[model samples]
Target: MTVVRAKLGAHLHSMTAPFLFVGSGLSRRYIGTEDWEGLLRKFAALTPRPYEFYRTSAEGDLPAVASKIAEAFYDIWWDSDDFSSSRKKWAGSMEGRESALKVEIAKYLSVPPALTGLANRESLEIEILKKAVIDGVITTNYDSLLA
Candidate 1:
């Protein structure tokens, strides 16, 4: 770990310019104003174990939970419309929301293990190297307040 950090530190230090490719991990937090988090929190409140599920990765398939979350989003959008819409519209909206929501949920479950491995790398960059993100950080996380 230390060796890898040293090598990366050396590489970064040698570079004429400084930049960091900070990704969604730095932005996404379980706490936020997003309807997704609210749904998850509500699910936790109703379930036998909320925090446990939040901390642990979903067992087996996650599609069921993902669907539930998707349904919640669709319901909200539908409620906002003053006039009744066809099922196709709701389905389309649900499909789009479902795709993005599922990706995020899967990312949430998978990111921790991946990040754990990179923890040393980040630590070395932040603490030992004291590198700066010279070009500024860019991310596409909707939950993030970068905009």
Candidate 2:
């Protein structure tokens, strides 16, 4: 979680906020088998269009290629009203969805390295954050996981 903390610190410094707010989202730790299936389902919901779009595009500039992938991801992310709205609520109007996704992606990136040698790999620091945010953690990304 140090990376998460460091990034957050850098962000707060850059923003120089009179008011700063945070909301919790899902970690892999929160996901159960069913929840995992559900998130995969959501991801699957958007994959085909993006995949096809990318497939059809003959010329691929690196930036354009990346943008195409993002557009596809956004298709899945934005389609579900509850999912999209929860993100907005958790993020408030101040933070962008990309910022939220970055934090989540970072957590996913960091967890594997940190837990590499552990016995019970799934249960770790995320539990503490989960407890702290029982009421406040409002993102739909992990709702099924927590439930």
Candidate 3:
């Protein structure tokens, strides 16, 4: 372990511009964002169907479940004729529900101000990485933490 650490330190010192590939687990660990199942469950609660229907029907496919939820939300939003004039105009001008769904999910996953504590080892590591002269960061997470 000591040898590996020394080698990694040497490599980091020698490397010119390193790139990062971040995953959802990093945000989940540091910022307390929900996992796929948890996120789906939240959205499922908004629908008339039980959460388990979406959770189990997806068979571990989160993207499918997300699509289903977005469709349902779109239908609900479209069918509602009770919106105020301003809201009606806004809703009519909108393009698609998928974009709105993404916005909602991003809001949900955002790290709250109180959860920004960086005293832990994981956060410390992220801080170090932020200070490094990296070339770029590639992440699969939908949140804008890297930005």
Candidate 4:
């Protein structure tokens, strides 16, 4: 373990441009973001059906679950005559909930408190990541912290 760590450290130091590919776990740990199921459950609560129905129906297929939830959301949005002008306009322009899901995920993952004073709260791992001479940080994460 010590040897591997030393070798990895050497390699990281020598690399000119290393890209970090982060996932939702990083956000969950540092920013307290929900996992995919948790996010789905939250959105499902807004639908007419109970959250468990959506949860069980998805059977671990998040994209499909999101599509189902999106349909429900569209229905709600369509039936509501009380929406603000801006909201109504936005809903009218939306093609589907996929984009809206991305927006919602981004909002949930982006915790302002976690990012504030980041430089002052750097951990050893964070410091090492900072030391890497990277051309860019690539992530599938929806949050703007890495941006």
TM-score list, all predictions: 0.33, 0.30, 0.66, 0.65
lDDT of 1 by residue, 6-111 (tens): 9999998888764556444554332223344443665444334453454344452344554554555444434544214433333454456455444334434433
lDDT of 4 by residue, 14-106 (tens): 878656778877776556666777787886776789766765677857777787777666655455554344354465556665645454445
How would you encode candidate 3's per-residue C-alpha lDDT over 1-147 as one tens digit per residue?
A: 999999999998888887778887777776666667677777777678877786577775778888777777666545545324424546555677765455556656664434356668876787787688778888887765565
The candidate 2 region of ten consecutive residues with least summed lDDT is 16-25
| Residue runs of model 2 more than 4 Å from their true location after superposition | 1-46, 50-52, 55-58, 81-90, 93-107, 110-147
Q: Please, what are the lDDT tens digits per residue for candidate 2 over residues 67-138?
A: 454455553555656456545655454344344433333333333224344345445654554455232333
Residue 82 of model 2, lDDT score? 41
All candidates: CA RMSD (Å): 10.8, 14.0, 4.8, 4.8
Please give the ranking of all candidate structures by TM-score, highest first, separated by commas: 3, 4, 1, 2
Judged by TM-score relative to the true structure, which candidate is superior, 1 or 3? 3
Any runs in candidate 4 off by more than 4 Å, and if so which? 1-15, 79-89, 97-113, 116-128
Segments in model 3 whose C-alpha atoms lie over 4 Å from true places: 1-15, 76-93, 97-99, 110-115
Which scores better on lDDT, 2 or 4? Answer: 4
Residue 30 displacement in candidate 1 (angstroms): 13
Q: Rate the local accuracy (lDDT) of all candidates.
A: 0.46, 0.44, 0.68, 0.65
Span of 10 residues, lowest total lDDT, candidate 4: 80-89
